[model samples]
Target: MLIEQSPSLPTVAVVGLGKIGLTLAAVFANNGYRVFGADINKGVVKTINQGKSHIRNEPGLDHLILTAQTNKTLSATTSTSEAVARADIIVVIVPVLVDDQNNIDYQFIDGAVQNIANGLKKGSLVIFETTLPPGDTKNRFGRRIEEISGLRLGRDFHLAYSPERVYSNRILQDLKNYPKVVGGLDKRSLELASNFYKQAIGCELIEVSSLETAEFSKVAECVYRDVNIALANELAQFAEKKDVNMSEVIVASNSQPYSHLHSPGIGVGGHCIPIYPYFFINKGLNQGLTPLSRKINDNMAEYAISKIERGIESFVDKNILILGLSYRENVKEPTKSTALLLIEQLRNKKANLFVNDPQFTESEITKYGVKPISLNDKAVSTIDVVILQAFHQEYSKIDFSQFSNCKFVLDGRNKLNKDEISQLGIKYEGIGL
Candidate 1:
């Protein structure tokens, strides 16, 4: 039911209430749209209805969700079919993954589409916010919905593709700041979807010619990052052999307007960077560059390990502490964390291991079969080598030189103060320094 004072806005159903989806639900509700969040997790639904935020990392999201629940604008349910039946607009943002062989797995997305099609109301607009292959939005999902829901395309229902572009910790701000990229099955679908997003998100709407363009644009964004990061990594590796600091070179080269170089790291992780390139590769695009870039980024963990082993005398019993576990700093989700890859390589060398991440509890860290110790603990001082993986803010508060017996600190992110660590008479090594 629509509220009397806010009857002008259409109701919204945000499916797959995970990181991006939950924030989308809260923001839409705060914007005076009655929103129903659909998730299979009953515990998550229960927590949201109680005016609590399931994800604690997103700034201002707790308050946004609380205000929405207090104003009775938002609630959640486990039934996707029921949510779609009640709303005028449906948004899908589930996970799409690649298997070990780099094959696209549509299990989660296919499930969401099936449920959405079951109770899809006539005249309702459907928008997909997941990252998919260039044609999956129109050919796979749009066609499947038309078949299952028995709704004629462009006549009985509308469909659009608007890939979720928000970062993990900056969803609310990105939602209002970034332009919403949208494309549709037809002209009318494009117009309706574009107008709704303009008011609902309170942001500029960037419309494309078709759904394929929108899908391809998102994949291209990830590919750009992946390819550039690979280039940076290649340069850093070469600079390491030549005794030249790649970090300083990056700073100098990126000064001009034409040059925009990314920082090299141990590895590229997260849902998008590591996974999206496979979508095009699976499509059999006769492109060697994308595949080669993916290979370079994927091999970085092994490269990082080799760098550590080159300096360290032995790894048989040396206590090695890896800082941070999540894919990125200050975020809890660890879909394809570089730390996991580093750990695998370290384990092969028979190094005694310990791990720490502020986002995870001590018990949680132990689940990975490693001891968890704090910076102040005596055991931390005995660590032979320290590897900075995620660069969480908590690591910033500690003194790096205080590790009494430490041989060197390998800063994978190159974010540490090189001067300070070196001035303190403690050895510091960045990716190429």
Candidate 2:
């Protein structure tokens, strides 16, 4: 049941006002709780205080922000400590990233902990919503909170871990719909967290035994996807050699109640899938599937570029325009996007590379060391190859004839209409098809 606004509802302090963080704040504010969002970005804070959303292309976010602001139940702040001091519950969604060597970097989480600890009071519940390696939630954060705040774990303050399970464009809906898995440092922390989310989220809550379980469950879920995608990628390559359509095969195989196979793509990129496997693999476990899958998925970028290379004679000065800049379809986030890896390979080959995405500005695309080219621009006539890295809806009805000199279209994602491209006198090839 949606609770009505009441003064008794605990105030929520949401640290990190990124897209997911901000959306969560708005939802909590609407759900009968006072919400204060904290971010280091002053501009984002100012935009929220003015009752406007700085995030674009997300459905209904602007109106939600407006409603929250109008009610004066939500506010923004530049200090995490400032926000934490006024709240009974503090939710930290600060990101924990992996570096190039696949080593976990806790800088952002460490900084957030420092600030949160400074203002953390006794008897408040602290829940971390970021996905971490198995025991880092307790070892990296829980102990640090105790040291800094001078509070006892179960008696003075509460600590728990709950992974964020929402997607980029569907955060609000997923939060209400998805099963929320939560674990705590102890039974006291678990009970308090379960009670808080039971009302704040109003979603079905699954309580586990320990913080490590909640943390591992999230990474395990992501690792499962990475492993399956690697299998699909390998199968896609074999299908390409055997002249079989992997997509059709997958459709047929998935018809069974027991078989579930993921799609094959040029690369797997996102905050979750590509990075989380390392959180498990780096535990120094001697696992075969996990490490091999990581290798296969990471190599997919080079494999895709190799396919394009075999199609053309030389990439020394060829005009190759990449169709999408984002790693995924329709979302503006480019974190660890496969398109970046492809660009690096093509750059080494010295191809004249260009990119276009409907979600990003020209300046944004150019920052990646590639010129931005639009399908409508007259310069499209000079391109030789078109690779569909991301299957954004805007590219569905693309006019192939516009690329007058284009010789091949490589559907890195199996999203393009091959029959239409071939009928238009262009050589069309999709992965595993």
Candidate 3:
């Protein structure tokens, strides 16, 4: 039974109030839809209901969320049933984590679908924005929703897949600007999902053939980045052995047509790139290449540690300071951070470690088993080595001369001025230069 399009604005329920989910909720609300956001966390629900954002450092998002709340177009609740009961469209954006044994955990997504099933009305369209293994959307997710709701997938309710394709900080802009890839269980399902997104997001839609294609597309994008970054990291290692500046080579090589070389850093971080490879591995496909790319990128952290050891002759007993704890610049998220991996390895050597990041508080830093200090703290002068793991904007203002006792500085992101650091009489080592 295909539900006729509502004459009034459709109510949208967005599950999981994480970064991506919250942003999508805001997008729908801003576009004049009555939006209900559902999260299991009571604190998140309370915060959103107060017309404030739980997500940090997103430009224009706070004002957009406040506007949505003021206009009575958006609200949040801890109970998923309450949000989904009257929603004409439901969007699931819960996370799918990869375990240590390289297994994809569907616990979060499964729980969210079960909650939706409890209140799922016939003729409502359900769309998933979370990344899943190729066939998991139709096989696992669609089947589970049907079993829990006692509704046929396409006949009683429409099911679709449209993976979220936005970066962390610029989610709002990317959501409106990027082309959305949408697929569904049937033609009617695809039309409903695509038309809703077309009007709600005001973005171009790329309709694919099936749900499996949509699922694989998102994973493929992340895997491509992971492989490209691994190539850059491998080249950097070769340049390190030959005493050549790999950044210079990269700049020169990228000038040629059809060349798109990624930058080499300590390691690839963030929730998507590092974890998406596991989805492919879980299916027992791409056994050799994907896993090897992951291994190469993973080892870059150890490679950075080896560089720090070489830079400081007496590394074991030295006092070291790490400048950034977040996975990337300007974002507070530490999911799959290479800096965390580096800190873990450094702690095993029994070195006195201090960390500073403008994005995190002192309490957050303590969780990593390191002393928290400000960038301009007086203790920085006594450190033997400074590792620049992330290049936060505030870090650009720091005076490297303050580290008078520092013998070496490892630039993991190529952030420091090599010539300036050399003039300060400190040994400088960068990832590729």
TM-score of each model, in listed order? 0.95, 0.97, 0.96
Task: Report the C-alpha lDDT of model 2 over 1-433, residue by residue, as the tens digit.
Answer: 0123347767989999888888888888888888888898999999999998888866778888899888887889888898898888999998888898888888988999999999998899999998899988778788898899898877898999889999888787889899999999899899989988888889999999999999989998998999999999999999988989899999999999899999998898889888888888888753899888989999998897788778787789998889888989999988888999989989999899999999999999999999998888999999999989999999988988888898889898989988888887778888788
Which residue pairs collide in model 1, if any? none
Q: List model 1 lDDT by residue over 301-335, tens digit each.
A: 88887777878866888889999888889999777
Each model's lDDT: 0.88, 0.88, 0.88
Question: Against the hidden true structure, what lDDT does model 3 obtain?
Answer: 0.88
Model 3 residue runs over 4 Å out of place are: 1-7
Q: Cα RMSDs of all predictions? A: 2.1, 2.7, 2.9
Candidate 1 ranges with C-alpha deviation above 4 Å: 1-9, 419-426
Q: What is the lDDT of residue 70 in candidate 2?
A: 89
